[model samples]
Target: MRKLLLPSLIIVAASLLVIRIFYLQVIDDSFKLKSDNNAIKIKYDYPERGYIYDRNGKLLVANQASYDIMVIPRELKNTDTLEFCQLLNITKEDFIKKIEKAKIYSPRLPSVFLPQLNKSEFAAFQEKIRKFEGFYFQKRSLRDYEVDSGANIFGFITQVNEKLVAKNPYYNSGDLIGRQGVEESYEDILRGIKGVKYIQKDKYNREIGSFKEGRYDTIAVQGEDINLTIDAELQKYGEELMINKRGGIVAIEPKTGEILALVTAPSYDPSILVGRQRSKNYTKLYHDSIAKPLYDRGLLAEYPPGSPFKILTGLVALQEGVVNEQTTFMCNHGFAYAPGRFQRCHCGGGPRDLHVGIYKSCNAYFSNVYLRTIGKYKSSPYAVDVWSNHIKSFGLGQFMGYDLPTGKKGKAPTSKTYKKMYPDWGWSGKTIISNAIGQGEVLMTPIQLANMMAAVANEGYYYTPHIIKKIEGKKIDTKFTTKHVTTIDKKYFKPMISGLFDVYNLGTAAGLRVEGIDICGKTGTAENFAKIDGKRVQLKDHSIFVAFAPKDNPKIAIAILVENGGFGATIAGPIASLMIEKYLRKKITRTDLETRILNTSLQAQYAKLGGLSEDIKLELRKNDSILKSKTVIPKIKIDSTKEN
Candidate 1:
C-alpha cells in the first residue's frame, strides 16, 4: 500500500510539471515581452504640427521638413569615432558628450544625437548612415513663419529637458515642446500623437523584419489646424509702426472680445527661432536685457493705467451715487490734498463736471468725487474694500483669464493692501486720492486696459478677451463665450461712454480724431520712476491711450502704451487713431499722421535711461535703415498712353 501511495504522489507531481512547462512555453507572454524588448528596435514617426492661420485665413505659421540624428546607447558598436564626427559636422568632444548624455537618459531608449539638420546636411549624412550602428535619422517638422510679426504671440518649440521628460510620460528624451504663446497654450491640440513601429532584430542587432507583421504599430495622426482672431495685416502694420520703440499695443474686436493684434516693440523675426541657429539667436536675444524682445509687454508689463483710468473713476463715482453727469467741482490746475502736498493736474483750473472732468482730465473733480464715494461708507477700510470691489468688477486687480500663457494682475488696492502699506496710521480717501487720477496704487496691463475699454464699448459687459477664435475640432471653453458683467450697473455706463466720447470730440484726444470715425478715447501720461543706486529717479512720462471707434456699436477697441514717450496725446493718441482708421477704413486717409509716427523714433528716449545696450543699438541701427528705406512711399505715375 505504501509503495502504491508514493507512486501516486510522483504521478501527480509529474502531471503538474508538465502543465507548468506548457504554460511557460506557449501561454505566458511576460518572458516573451522581455525577449522582444532586447531584439525589437522601436522607432517613432513624428507627425507635422498643425498650421496656424489668421482670422481671415491668411497663413501665419506653417511647417517645414527637418531631420534629427537619433541614438540608442546600448546598441552602439565600436566604430571609427573621428570619421563619424567629421561626417556629421561635429567635433570628437561633442560626439563623446552627446553619447554620454544619451546613455544617461537611457541605454535602451532613443535620444537625439544631432538635431535640426538642413537638406544638404541630411543628404550628406544619409549616404554613410548605414555604417553607423545604433544610429538613425528621424524626420520631423519645424515652424516656418509666413509673416515676420507676432514673435511674442507665435512662440517657438524646443527640445524638452530632463525635468519635463521625468514629469510627463507622454514626452521622452529629445522631444520638442512649445515654449510660449499660442504654441504653449494649445500644445496638445497642435502636437499630434506620435506613431511608433517595432522592428524585429536578430541576435547580432541586425534589422530582420517588422515585429508581428507591424500589428502593434500605429499611423501618425496629423495635428488639427487652428484659426486665431488676429488680423495678419493689422499685426504687421502695428509691428511696422512700433519699430525702434519700446512698448506694447493691444487691439480687440469690441463685440466679440477677440484680440485683433498684439504688438510688442523690439520683437525679432520669428524665423530667427527656427533651425540650427535657434540656440545661438535665442541666447543673444535673451542676454540683451536692455531690449527684451522676447518679453510680451502687452500681457506682462504692469504699469499705472494713468489718465485712461480716469474713465473708471468717473464710472465708479456715478455707480456709488457720489457724483453724477451734472456734478461739478473746481480744479486750480491740480487737486490740493493736503496743505503742502497737492496732486498736480494739467487741465486748466475751472469748474468741471463728469463730462468736462473726463475730457479735461481734471484731477480736482475726480479727487473730490473719490473722497465722497469713500466717505459714503462708514469706515475708510470698508470704503476701500467697496471701491476695490467696484474697480475689480471691471477685471482689474486680477488675472483676466486671457488665452495667453502669461499675464500680470494689475493692482486695485483693497483695504488689506492699504493696511499692509500703512499699518500704523488709519487710511482715508484723501490719503490715497492719487488713485482718483489713476496714479497712486492703480496698475494695469495693456490687455487689461484694452479689455476695460471693450467693456465700456459693450455698455457694461465684455466677453473674455481671447486670441483663439476657433479650434479645428473642438469648441472653445465656455468662459470665453460667456459675458463677464461688471459690478457697475448697466445704466451707469451711459454717462461714462458719453464722457469718453467727449474725449475725442472736445477733450484731451480731440485733436487726434479720425476724419469720419467717431472714436472715443482717453489720453494718459503715467509718471515713470525707477530706483537707481538706491535712489528714486523720475524718468520721462509714459504715453498711454485707450479707445474704441465708431462710438456706438463699436468695432474696435485698442490700448497703446509708449514707455518714456512724453504726453499721451503726442504719441499714443495718434497711434491709436491710426490703428483704428486702418482697421476700419482699410487704408490710411491721414498719411500725415502715419508719416509723423513712422518717421518718429524713440531711440533717444530709450538711450537716456541706459535702455539700449551696444548690441541692441547695433541691431536697432540696422533695422532703422531697413525701415527708412521701406517706408519711403514711391510716386505713382499717370500712364497717359494707356489711360482709360
Candidate 2:
C-alpha cells in the first residue's frame, strides 16, 4: 500500500507540472513576455507628432528627424565604454549615471542615454553603434518651427520624470512629454501611438529574425493634425510690435471666441527650445527673474484692469436698474464720498453721463453709479455679494478654463474677501470705491480682459475663448462653442457700445484712431506700485487698452497691457490701433507709428529696480543692445494676410 501511494503522488505532481506549463505557455502572456525578454530584443517605432497649422492653413509647427542613444541596463555586456562615450561626446561618468538611472526605472526596459543628436553626430555614430551590446539608436522627431513668433502658444517638450512614469502606464522611461501651452493641453491627440517590434536573438545575442514571424509587430499610427485659430501674420506683427516692451496682448474673434494672436513680450525664438541645447537655454531663461521670458503674460499675468474695467461697471449699473443711459452725475475733479475723502479723476470735471463717463474715463461718474448699484440692496455684504455675482457672470474672478495648461484666476473682491480685509470695521461701497475704477481688489489677466471685450462686442454673451479652432477629423469640445450670457440685458450693451465707439472718435483714445476704420477703444493708466526695501513705492503706471473695430459687426476684440508705460493713450492705444489696422486693412499706411513703437525701449525703466540678479542684468543689457540696433521695418504687404 505504501509503494502504491508514493507512485500515485509522483504521477499527480507530474500531471500538475504539465498543466502549469501549458497554462503559462498558452493562456498567461505575462510569463511569455518574461521568456521573450530573455531571447528577443524589443524596439519602439515612434510616430511623427501632429503638424500644427494656423487658421489660414499655414504650417506653424512641423517635425524633423532626430536620433537618441537608448540603453537597456540588463542587456549590457562587456564592451569598450570609453569608445562609446567618445562616439557620443559624453563622459564615462555620465554614461554610468544614466545607466544607473535607467536601472532604477527598470533594468529590463530601455531609457535614453543621450538624446537629440544632430545629422552629423548621428551619421558618425551610426557606423560604430553596433560595437555596443546594450545600446542602439532610436529615431524620433523633434519640433521644427516655421516662424519665430508664438513661443508662448506652442510650448516645448521634455522627458517625463519618474513620478509621471509611475502615474501614466502609457509612458515609459525617457519618454518626451509636452511642457506647456497647446502642446501640453493636446498631448494625447498630438502624440500618437508607438508601435513595437520583437526580434529573436541567437545564443551569441545576435538578431536572427522576427520572434514569431512578425506576428507581434505593430504599425505606427501618425498623430492627428490640429488647426489653431492664430493668424500667422497677425501673430508675427503683434510680436514685432511688442519687442523692447514687457507685457501681454491677446486678440479674440468676437463672434466665434477663437483667439487670433497671443503675444508676450521678450519672447525667445521657438527653435531655441529644441535639440541638445534646450536645457542650457531653458536654464538661462528660467533664471532671468526680471524678464521672465518663459512666463506667459497673456494667460498668467494678473494686473489691475484699469479704466477698461469701467466699461463693466457701466454694464453692471445698467443691469441693476440703478442707472440708465440718460442718468447723469457731476464731477468736481473727483467724487467726494466721505467728508474729506475723494476718488480723483483725470477727466476735466463736468456734467458727465454714462456715455461721457466711459469715453472720457470719469472716475467720479463711475463711482457714483457704483454707489447707487450697491445702495440698491439693504445689507452691505449682500450688496457686495450681488455686485460680485454680477461681475462673476462675465467670467471675471475665476479661471476661464482655457485650453492652455496654465492660467491665473485674477481676483475679484467678494463680500467674504472684504470681511477678511476689514475684520473689525464694517465696510461699504465708500470703503471699496476703488473697485468702481478697476482698482483696489479687482485684477484680471490679458486674456480675461480680451474675453470681456468680446462679450461686450457680442452685445450680451460670449463664447469661451479658445486657441484650437479645429482638430483634424474631430469635433471641438462643446464648452468652447456654448454661449455664456452676462448678467446685463442685451439692450444695455448698445449704450455701452456707443460709448466705446465715441472713445475712438472723441475721447481718451481719440488721438490713436486708425484711418478708414471705426475703431472703438478705451485707454487706461493703472498706477503701478512695488514694495522696495519694505517701502511701497509707486512706479510708472501701466498702459492698458481694450478695443473692438468696425463697431456694428466687430471682427476683432483685443486687450493690451504694457508695464511701466505711463498713460494708456501713450503706448497701449497706438499699439492696439496699429494691430486693428493691420488686421482689417492688411497694410499699415501708418509706418511712422509702427517705426516709433518698434524703436521705443523700456529697458531703462526695468533696470531702475535694485533687487535684480546679475544674470538678469546681463540678459537685460543683451536685449537692450539688440533693441538699439537699427533694423528697417519692412513694408508688410496685404498679401501676407491672404488665406493659404
Candidate 3:
C-alpha cells in the first residue's frame, strides 16, 4: 500500500511540471510582443529627389537643405505659444489653428509647424527648440531652382495630399509630390525609395539605440536622375528676348526630336515659390491679369495657325494631285467670290504658280487648290473626310502627345463635329474653304506646329516631341523613337521644299532671312477678340512665324508666337531667326532687331479679360479714389501679328 501511494504522488508531480512548461512556451508570446512594441519605434527616412540637368550636363533643378519645425501634439506641454508665434512670424491665433490641423493629421506623430525655414530663421528656432519638450527640428529637402526661371516646365514640389496617399500606397502623407510639368510626368522615376529605421527608446521617449544594433535598418536609395533636352543658355536668352511680349518659342532638333529651348515670356522666378512663402508668392503671380504668367503658351495656347497652314495646304495639294509645282492661278489683288465679298491678297496682280503662290502666300491660290483637292475625290463627303484624315496624320487637330503634361488638342472637326453645327443636307468643297487657308476652325499648339515642320523636314516622317531625354541613364519610352509616317511621299517633299525656300528668298519672309543661310519660313497674322467697356473690341493681331534653317538638310524646326505683334515678318520672324541662329550657330548678331521687338507696343494691356463683361468694369471703377490708388503696373510691348 505504501509503495503504491509514493508512485502515484511522483506521477502527479511530473504532470504538474509539464503543464507549467507549456504555459511559458505557448501562452506567454503575446506578453513578449507587447513588451517589444513598447520598446521600439518605427521611423521612415525619406530619400533625396533626383537632380535635373540639361543636355550640356548643367544642373537646372536640384535640392536645397530645408528645416521644418515639427511637433507631436500629445507630447507637447508647457510650450510658450506667444514666443513660438513670434519666432515663426505669425500671430498667436494663426499658430493655434496650425496646431489644430497638425493634430488632425496625427497626435503621436510629428507634424510640420514652420516649413522650409531659411538659415536665419532656422538658426533662431534651433536655439529655442530645446526648451519645448514635444517639438523638434527635422531636416528635409526642397526644390531649388538654379536658373530662376522655367517655372511652368520645371514645376514645383509640395506635400502629398490625402487624396494622393489614398491612390498610391507608396506615398506617405508628409512626402513631397510633383505638381506640374516634367516634375509631375516623371514622379515615379524621380522619387527614390524610402528607408526605415527600427529604433529602441528609453523611458523618457528619447531614442536610446537602433533595434538589434541597426541590423534591420534599411539604407535610403537615391532617386533616378533626369537628363533634359533643353539648352540652358539658349532658353535663358530666348526668355529675355521675349520679355514684355506674350508668346512662346519651341525649338527642336529635327533629326533627334530634342527640344533645345522652350521659352514662355512673363515667367516668374521659380525660386520664389519654394518654402513657407509658396502660397503668398503664388497669389501675387496668379492675380496678374495682363501677362497670365502661369499660362503655358508654348504647349497650351492654341491659335488659328494662319499662313503657316499654307505649308500644310501646299503639301496636301501636291500629294493629292490637285496641284503641281507649275500649276498657275491669276491673283489680281483679290478673288471676287460674290460681287462685293472678295478674298483680298497683299500680293498684287500676277500669274502665280503653286510655288509662287506659296512664296507670296496668296489666299486665292489656296482657296482654289482646296476646292480642287477635295473635289478630286469620288464624293464631296469622302474628299473632306480624307483630307481631314491626312491633316490628323500630321499630328494636327489632335494632341501632339508630347511628354509634357496638359496639352490642348487644337480643334480639328471630325465630320461628326461639323454635322452637329451645319445640319448639312448636301456638303460641298466650298463649305470647308476656310480650312484651306489655315483659318476658321483650324487651331494648333506651337509644339504641334513645330512637329509639323519636323515631318516636312523629314520628308514624310517624324518622332514624337519629348522633353525628357533620359532618366536614370535610360532614355524615355521607346515609342518616342518610333517614326510617325505622314501620308505624303518622300519625293513629294522635294518640290515643297523649293516653295518654302523661295518663301525666304522671294516671299513675305524674304527680307528677314540671314545671308548664306537657307531658311524656309511661313508667316501669319491672326485676328483675336478682346473685351473693353461692355463691347467686343478688335484687339491687336497675333504675329506668328514657323521656320527651319539649312532647309535642304534641316537641323532645327522652330515655331514662334508673338501676341498682338503686328506682321509676322517683322516681329515674330526675327525672334525665330535669332533663336535658330543661337541654337545652330551659337551666336546672335541682331541686337538692334532684338531690342526693337522687345520694346515695341503695349496696347493690349488695357484690353479687359474676355470672361469679365463690360458692365462689371464700370462697377469696379465707380469710385475715382479706388481707381486712382493704382499699383505701378509693368509695361508690356506686344507685336500684333499672327504667330502660330
TM-score of each: 0.90, 0.91, 0.88
lDDT score for residue 644 of model 2: 4
Candidate 3 lDDT, 120-195, residue by residue in tens: 8899988888888888876677888779657778888887888987798787556788877888999888878888
In order, candidate lDDTs are 0.83, 0.84, 0.76
The candidate that wins on TM-score is: 2
For every model shown, the clashing-pair count is 0, 0, 18
Off by over 4 Å in 3: 1-39, 202-204, 338-340, 601-644
Of the candidates numbered 1 and 2, which has the greater lDDT value? 2
Residue 145, model 2: lDDT of 95
Best prediction by lDDT: 2
lDDT of 1 by residue, 1-644 (tens): 98799999999999999999999987764455444377887788898998999999999999999999999888788868988989877799999999999988789888999889888989998998888988898899899999888888889999999999889988878788888999999999999999988888898777999887887788888888999999998998998888767789999998898999999887878888888889988887775555667778899888888788878888888888887788889888876777797777778789998888888878788888888888898655878888889889888999988888999998999888888999998888888887877777788899999999999998888988999988898998788888888888889888788888888888888789788888888998866566544555566677899999889889999999987777889888899999999999889987888999888887766655533346555654544322211111011111110000
Candidates 2 and 3: which is better by TM-score? Answer: 2
Alpha carbon deviation, residue 549, candidate 3 (Å): 1.0
How far in Å is the alpha carbon of 457 misplaced in model 1?
0.4
Q: Order the candidates by TM-score, highest first.
A: 2, 1, 3
Query: Ten-residue segment with the worst summed lDDT in candidate 2?
Result: 635-644
